[model samples]
Target chain A: MTRSPFTNPYVLILPGFLLSAFIILWPLFQLGNISLSEVNRFGQIRGFAGFENYLAVFNDPDFYGALWRTLIWTFGIVIGSIGTALPIAIVLHEDFYGRGLARVIIMLPWAVSLTMTAIVWRWALSGESGMLNSALMGLGLIDTNIQWLAQSSTAFPMQILIGILVTVPFTVTIFLGGLSSIPDDLYEAARLEGANPFQLFARITLPLIRPFLNIAIVLNTIYVFNSFPIIWATTQGGPANSTDILVTYLYKLGFRFGKLGEASALSIMMFALLLFFTLIYVVLAMRGEKE
Target chain B: MKRTWLLSVAGAALLSLNATAQADTLRVTVAEYSSKTGPYFEEAATAFEAANPETDVQIEVVPWDVLLQKLTTDISGGANADLSIIGTRWLIDFVDQGIAAPFDSYMSDEFNDRFFPTFLSPSVMDDKTYGLPIAASARAMYYNKDLFEQAGISQVPNTWEDLAAAAEKIAALGDDVYGYGMQGKEIETDVYFYYAFWAYGGNLIDADGTSGLDSEAGYQAAKLYKSMIDGGLTQPGVTSNTREDVQNLFKRGKVGMMITAPFLSSQIATEAPELSYGVAAIPEGPSGARGTYGVTDSMIMFENSEVKETAWKFLDMLFEAEWRSKFTGGEGFLPVNKAVAAEPAFADNADLKAFAAVLPDARFAPVIPGWEEIAAATSDALQTIYLGDGEVEATLDGAAEKIDRILGN
Candidate 1:
């Protein structure tokens, strides 16, 4: 007897299931196991130590500091990116001069390599001999050159600014796609009802782009939370751990300090935090859709 | 078509078999220096291959920042090289993990006595020698003579007080030049701090494995550096500058003096030849003790290597007096071999001679399992002190407590 392709869905999905098991589930299981054990410098498992690594991470002050910093870093980038992108996306959606060229120019930051962006920003922000400093001084904006990446206060803000700069282009592209998907009939009807630009935007554009905004904010939060190269290349989370996020701190624990077990524990915490946020967002979006 | 395909397959198999039979290839990895081609290793490899026709040496150059990570991955994945140059501080960990093979069985008394005692100490763990030192460096104060002359400094600073006075004098020149350049960033921040710490008679760990950072010597060292930053003797953004940045500043004739290793000599020659510079021993502290931070890299053989004898033969060829001299001199590193130091090339170079003078008094950081973490913690503490985030003594005490916990005390 001949069988249809969908007769046994499990059989058809076996390859994908096996691939996910091998690539994702297996490593996650290993990470969970490692988080509960004692791992030495040589990557050797020195027997299991139940809850020891977790307790250590919980009590560590650096971990708490990194948690707080990660929140600030994540929120700052997500909010700043969306805030900047929404306006630009609206403008770009309108018919304007050099709109194609403007889109390309706006997306350039997203196209450049992150490491290259970091290095270029570092050079420009250098205190002693930087183009930014030279231009500022030339314009009589400040009496003395400031070390943007060297000071604790400025370092975190500068990194956040760069994060926002790199994130906005992608956010704008997504918003533009979302804007295009909104039918022009709704906008025309609102305009024909004598709706102002702001009123039309508030009633039509805002409600229509909620899904895109949700995705952009959640994804950008995850991306910025896990970002490493920008902080590592710029300040190394330094000038006294002022800018350290969870991932860079995890890196120090695992690679620099050779504490795999502790690093694994920290990794699980990071994953749990991100997953919790993701689940809440998903649930909220689903509920909204149901309403 | 069937005959042609079979003949081609057979030919490829025969050629591969013949290639394998002709040469026993040994894989060697070395840390990358500033030189793009790694001329020292290339020259040594070529000479060793010439001397041992049956053995082929494949050299892999890795940058220092990622060398340990690469080696760790390779060892875990069972793809470790037959022989590799590793930082001496990592020797004990490698030995403990059973990844490195002891060299005692292969060494003769004459051959064993070739290395300087100080340079050889880090490779010996529990009286079992696991590696041989290939390159060594000692930190010293490098001063730009033109900057000093412009500041009207005739004599090099001799004491911490003298150094501070000289720095103030240089800073007074006032063309945006810093008097002292401190490396507050990664790679060797702890080492730079130790230059002052050791000179002040401080130690990282005592006999009982307790941290000594809270001692008066440590406080004094931290305070001295803090005072330098506060007094404007250092660059404005001292916390952000790495050793490389400070080196660039000095090369640009903007900094008066920086404490760095001898490797900077070659860099200065190539990057800033017109800039005149002088090398001198670091200033003595108030305690009347002088110290220089010594770092060494050694060639280690892996326990899993199949071609052990061929690897040993290649090592022997590379360590011959002539080749060793050329390797050290060409790379601008201090020699591990006694005969290499006597070579005219090193002896004639004034900067090399200056660095050589301080080798006898050089001291290495403690070779322990968690020393890297300790160094990082200490660097953070020093940066905090420099930035005036906390009181020096309290911050150092806090760092010492953290270190003690890391030491499992």
Candidate 2:
């Protein structure tokens, strides 16, 4: 098994390494470089502004508002989506009538794009002709049409609900995989020990699936936070920019307004924020392993 | 030894000759709408190459969003095609970024004088021609003749009051039928609403593109829109609907009338054959103004392009009356060239004729670099007004502030 020190095993992966560097690392480096410079209308780098771009963005009210909105958007989508998904996963895990069809139907949203799903839901929730409003009125539940996506107060909730709808399928699939891996004998023992369904979920299911939940939450958080198409297609974060997430605001700065420097700074800040969340998840998981 | 040296020189010369042959070819990226006009891009390219045997032209068709992204990215990276189709609204931004090349020197005075001034004006900044209009669309009230007949109405309304009455009569048909269709979403659709609003006595900002959102006219416009929604004349999904959905509803015979761009004529004739529609000027407002917003796409050359002459030649060919009439007319694009409207294809088409007739009343969107941001803010304010949760004045005022932020005012 003796090998020459010069015959490096890593050298064999040179092509793959080169490809990764070209595609991933190079873009990251370029993104970093652009964050430090001013890109003009023609996409040429004009001058170096040091961290003035970052400083300007940090002080801008829109950026601050987007930061807040992004937090709320992430928090609402992550917590709400996972909260809805885990229960559905646990329920689908149990044998029931039409369970196969139900699983397929539940996963249907995943088959479609998040943008398409948002569009359909946007239509369904429209003030005048939306199915929800029609049904509500038909049931004598309300006499007036409710502007679900039009008001600042209702728009955020509507966005979060749509995010949850689009995200639930992925979360449920991940959790279902985790649930199936758990031995039935463990649940049976818990049941025999006088644990109820709720107790079984709390004691056995929750503990065993915590790791999966962490993965699901972190992934969903990133996807939901960075999502642009749904927000753009539906609201463009409107009704006074009340629904603007960081990504949409970033998009406005870069594309709509042509503020490349500010947009790049916003992007870097977003990366930092997401990285922070990822580190927290990793730490929690490591702590869970220790426990 | 002398013979060997002579053969080596001959091989190097042959290699240099091959490169010169390849240099004749030009690659371009254009929107799919532009491709639909002729034999796709390939056909037009073939024609261009045939006309100029020395030069070869190639075109790549891209979706609108992809085209915008590609154009921006390419320009930013100091690389771009010689020419491409871009929305007129984006012209200002592109010019500001210095990606667009001014074509004044390449354009003949006669050709420049032939265009509808507004369509040309957006492409002209600081007295320089940055682009040429490839296709243009003007918004107008498209009313369904059959729906009017069903509702016992004979004439399309010429004033706002008459229009309102017609909408009321048509809305009486059933819950599935709407008297009018308007763009109610948060993006470009809102701009359509603004056209009517401005006609009704609203102005976003002054003519100089300042903050006019909070003005009396703007308030009246917001309130008028709210009244339409509140009065039950608008469709069920009006507030959250996109332009496509509104068009679809009209084509499905669900809407009795709508304000839409001229391009919808193809769909009205093909998909909604049962519904006979007529185009009319946007009804006169309280201000006694009859107007519609004009949208156009222009052929812009990038500053970094190495093939400026080739690009200009291609654009000139695109705007040629006969070629454009055949190309844009076949693809259902409204020709931007004023002379092209007189061509047999557009002139003979009844729907296009009605649309073309409204050209005298058409106006362009305000050509400002921050127009998009202001448009978005105004749309949001309008949405809030629709909800009845925000005051028209306050919403407009807030929107004005946001507009100022975008305009750096």
- Give Cα-based local distance difference scores for all models: 0.87, 0.78
Give me candidate 2's interface root-mean-square deviation. 2.8
What are the candidates' individual DockQ scores?
0.56, 0.43
Q: What DockQ does candidate 2 score?
A: 0.43
Candidate 1 fraction of reference contacts recovered: 0.53
lDDT of candidate 1 over A1-291, digit per residue (tens): 888877688988999999999998898988898899887665667789999999988988888889999999999999998999999999999999999999999999998999899989888888888888999999999889897877769889989999999999999999999999999999999899999999989999999999999899888988888999889888888977778899989988887777889988989988999999989988999799789
Superposed model 1: Cα runs more than 4 Å off: A1-6, B1-25, B37-57
- Local accuracy of candidate 1 as per-residue lDDT tens digits, B1-409: 9999999999999989867775588899999866743777887788777877877788999988778878876875588899999889888788887889988888889888788888888789899889898888998899988888988999999888889889999999995888999888777888888888888998889777889999999999999999999999998888888898889999998899899989899988888999988999999988689889888888999999998988888888778788787777667789888888777777688888888788777888788788888888898898888888999999999999999998888
Pairs with backbone N, CA or C atoms under 3 Å apart (clashes), candidate 2: A41-B97, A42-B97, A43-B76, A128-B236, A129-B236, A129-B237, B202-B217, B205-B212
Off by over 4 Å in 2: A1-25, A50-52, A55-65, A84-111, A119-159, A176-203, B1-21, B34-39, B50-56, B109-118, B147-155, B172-174, B200-209
The prediction achieving the highest DockQ against the true structure is 1
Candidate 2 lDDT over residue span B289-337, tens digit each: 7677777888888787777888778777777776777767666767667
Model 2: lDDT of residue B145? 83
How does candidate 2 fare on TM-score?
Answer: 0.85
